[model samples]
Target: MVNRHRGETALMVSGETLPMRLTLGALAELEHAFAVDSLPALGERFVEGRLSARDIIRIIAAGLRGAGRAIRDEDVAELSFDGGLNGVIKAAIALLEATFGEDDASRPPQPPA
Candidate 1:
């Protein structure tokens, strides 16, 4: 079962459903991949909305790994999804939204300081 509360989303490939998430570690990996200094920088980079084919692969791959699936970018590149490239793009965007969301309001409530 997919759990949005924990940032879990599903990716469909070859008629199979795979669970995906952008956990803390996965987000860190993305920061490194994008050569950003901090989480906010990474968010800025993504918000720019300029992504390549490889970028999409890296995202889906990391999301798979975040959900405990040992997968590689090469393998992800080979998979055929339902909506094809568009499907993968949608999944990636959804994953990003699930992680960072639209704005500060979308962020999780912070505890009392």
Candidate 2:
């Protein structure tokens, strides 16, 4: 359930807010990992809707393994769903906001004549 309001998509988990720093870190880490593993092609396949959630998890696991990271079976299980994806995206946004301060609206918009 993607909710778009006020020009921002709401990516919350269980109605709980995540800290910006953590979220950003997670997003950055995921992106960095993907790049390091040269899995953009796989990601493109996923984006094209050719990959299932399990396929994505498998790709991620393989990437992790290639990077000398140990991925437990449970970890793969945990990431195979919409909830996990939402959590990751939300966390990334929070992290980005933390790295760069929140946006400010100091000036009022002019009314249409």
Q: Pick the candidate with the highest TM-score.
A: 1
What is the number of backbone collisions in each predicted candidate, taken in the order shown?
A: 0, 3
Candidate 2 is scored at a TM of 0.30
TM per candidate: 0.87, 0.30
Q: Summarize candidate 2's per-residue lDDT along 1-113 as a digit string, tens digits.
A: 22122122222335653212222333345456445443454244335545445544544444333334466535855643336775554433433333333344544665899
Question: Candidate 1: misplaced stretches above 4 Å?
Answer: 102-113
Worst 10 residues of 2 by lDDT: 1-10
User: What C-alpha lDDT does candidate 1 achieve relative to the native structure?
Assistant: 0.89
